[model samples]
Target chain A: MSVRHSMVKGMQNSVGYFISTFLFGIMFGVAAAASGLEQWQGLLMSGMVFSASAQFAALEFWQSPLPLGTIAMSVFLVSTRNILLGMSMTHHFDNHSTGRKILWLFILNDPGVVTAIRLDSGIDKLGYITGYGITLMLSWLISTWVGFNLSNIITIADFGAMDFAGPLMLGIMMVLFSKGSAASPIPWIISGIAALVLHEIGLPAYLILPISVATGIASAMTNRHRSHPPKGETRIKANNND
Target chain B: MTMTTIIMMAGIVYLTRVSGYFIGLQFRHIGELRPILEALPGCAMMAILIPAVRQGDIVDFTSLAVVLGMMWKTNNVVVSSVLGMAILLFGDNVISGS
Candidate 1:
């Protein structure tokens, strides 16, 4: 109870955070360069969007004849997960001024959202988000810049093992999320199933992640209710028990 | 040409971020939904990764093993990742050579 974990603390303490950011950043930069985008293009996209996963996904749509419509659709679909994320943070931002509240809307990425969600209670919410968001943004931009330039000198995939970097980072986060009693595996199972099924049905990759997440949450709610029944529902805590 | 393309891409992503907050604020008072929202990211990761693992080859499985093993042993993402990357690269190279 005494030792509190905030978004700020998570940002400072996690070594994986630094490595994953840089790794993914470089992966994005190199991929962009390989796709025939200039270094400046990579920087602009990374700086403006600040989402490694979506940026990576966007590269798939970077082919010539420029599927602008398709690319926009995919990026939008991929990033729509943020709506769920932003909603999750609304309570924390409800008390802040309008402008201050709006600031986080643009900066919140996946890890930043996770950090914010994990850092509940007895911490400066704004400070935590700022530290987490800004740190990632800078590292992402810098790595993209570096990755683009270095793409010429080094073969990107050989050095970075780019394919393995993202899933590895994700595995690390999945590990973090299961830390408490409430962090049940059932929802994850359900989500995975839903995602696979949707994929098999030919849904785009961008649409799959968020839809599956919703299905997972629904399954989790059902499991929670079944285990405790209505009488014990109030005892389930969001931190670990539910 | 690249500038226009990148800007379009950035705009789309930026809109997602901003739109999410707007949508999130609407649900602030719905206490029952909090857990669902909070848990979505973790579930999303699982959903996202499962297919990849299922579809991958030996190298992918090995990569998964390395990640889980290191994280399980160290209970530290940073240490495990750095170490896991080394194991994956070494193991992958050996397999490729063989």
Candidate 2:
């Protein structure tokens, strides 16, 4: 594709991602509100934390008065994917200035990582990453505030019904993640079994996040030497050059 | 917690987030840890979903129905969520009536 065409396609993709991400943000806001966080606090969490899982976990831990170490550990375990995401983009970003790389690292969430992996050229990586991050950040900030404010207007019963929005959004995210994967079911099965066993053993509900991560990592590590390319493989010859 | 306490808690949360960036950059070169890091989110989702499916203080027939509906309607998140809530409400009413 020509530079112009690629730019346009990138723009179109960014816009579509922004819209879906915004809806997901609204869902986050609703969930946060239902969880009893005040309006401004929810907005602040979205703006500052910028992570759905961490934010939700923090909210749950809020009432517990858990030690900082415990909270940090949970957040660390949940947000560990950012590390893998950072690795995948490192080759593409090797040539960029240190400041740009730092900024990218700061904003590297799942969507940003996914967008980076899908790019056809390394030249567009920074642009797409920036676009995805900025759009996601704005949507999260605004929708969180909206949900917080909306919480007061809606009854608990309504909020209970709407609470499904967050999980449903995540389920959609998983579907998006699983596209084109012939062996996707394997990881899902392994993770599901691990989760069941852990829950039966009396692990906390939030621990599921880390357990799933362990399961996926174990599965991936065990199969790493396989012949197939890992899932979400993008073709960026420029990346190799960088 | 008091308003002042909540505000302080929020500040701590912000610090943790900023800390993640620095931590990520520091450990960026550690490629050996990549697979486990990548798989954590999926593992977490499964962990949460398993208990969510069973009958208990939080899980029940209603929750299971919701999860099943979500799995079945993989594309329509809104519909699945609504169906799940409907089942929960119906289940709640039936148990109370009984």
Candidate 3:
């Protein structure tokens, strides 16, 4: 398919996310304004960071004179997942030009990357991701601005269970990422168990992602080895037995 | 927040965004790690999701199940999500209210 075609398709796919993102952005703007940010400051934050989760978390720690250390740590921790996300996209971005890579990565948010990977194969991955990113960024920035302006009128409580949207998207993403393969469920089960155990045992919240992912990776690796029968006669026997 | 703080936060997030790609690039040629790379995204999703779901009440659980079932059946993220959210809103407002 042509790059333009893929880009337009990407934008179309992103329309699904735009609504939730726009709502969330308005909510963020209200929260940011209530939290003592000027209109420009909130806009700047939305524009520069472009991460709703991290921006929300940072707002929780927003204070006068700037608790730099606390806010920085919270932002970093909330953003840690993006690193893995970026890593996952390496295959898609590997062939693009350096400038393209930078521009694409600049707008790389969760919804965009998830959509890029979830969509059908054969389209121009670069164009698709760029389109998805641009759409989401625009939705976020515009909604945040709107929310900021309407802060005094609509309170955060005006939205009910809106936070659930993030988790819902994540859950959808999990299904999308694991739909085809037989053994794919194994890693998710492992990751879930690890996350629960770590959280229950009082591991720092930030540590959960890395540790659980490692366990999942280990399980996948082990499962891969087990599924592939070892050596000669056993392998043939295993295949025939199947 | 000041420009400096905003810059710092942006810088930190931007680093997270790009570092993973660069890091993955390092291991890109490693034939052995390909499976791990492939599994990373799903695992990461579960790692974040499981705890949140665990902490949630019945409404959250039901909605999650609905979301998963719909996605499994249809493979349409948008529809599954909207249905999930609808269930969530319904459960929270209607069932719980009644």
User: What lDDT does candidate 2 reach at residue A220?
Assistant: 71
Candidate 3 second chain TM: 0.68
- Tell me the lDDT of model 3 at B43: 74
In angstroms, the error of model 3 at A88 is 9.6
CAPRI classification of candidate 2: acceptable
lDDT of 1 by residue, A45-148 (tens): 88877876567556654677676765666466546567766766666665567786666556776666666677657665655666677777778888898888
Over the true interface, candidate 1 deviates by an RMSD, in Å, of 4.5
Model 3 spans with C-alpha error above 4 angstroms: A1-46, A49-105, A108-132, A143-160, A180-183, A228-242, B1-28, B86-90, B93-97
Clashing pairs in 1: A16-B78, A83-B20, A87-B24, A182-A240
Q: Pick the candidate with the highest lDDT.
A: 3
Instruction: Calculate the i-RMS of every candidate, to one decimal place.
Output: 4.5, 5.0, 5.2
Across residues A35-59, which tens digit of lDDT does each residue of candidate 2 receive? 6667776776676677766655444
**Candidate 3 or 1, higher TM-score:** 1
Better of 1 and 2 by TM-score: 2
Question: What does the lDDT read for residue A226 in candidate 3?
Answer: 86
- What are the per-model DockQ values? 0.45, 0.31, 0.41
| Poorest lDDT segment (10 consecutive residues) of candidate 2 chain B | B52-61
Q: What shift in Å separates residue A114 of candidate 3 from its native position after superposition?
A: 10
Query: What is candidate 3's lDDT per residue for A1-242, written digit by digit as tens?
Result: 77789888889988878986886686677667767789998899889999876776566546676877756765775576677678878877656788778766877777667767876768877788778878988999999999777755544333345445556656765675576434467877898799999989987556776798789889999988887645795878889999
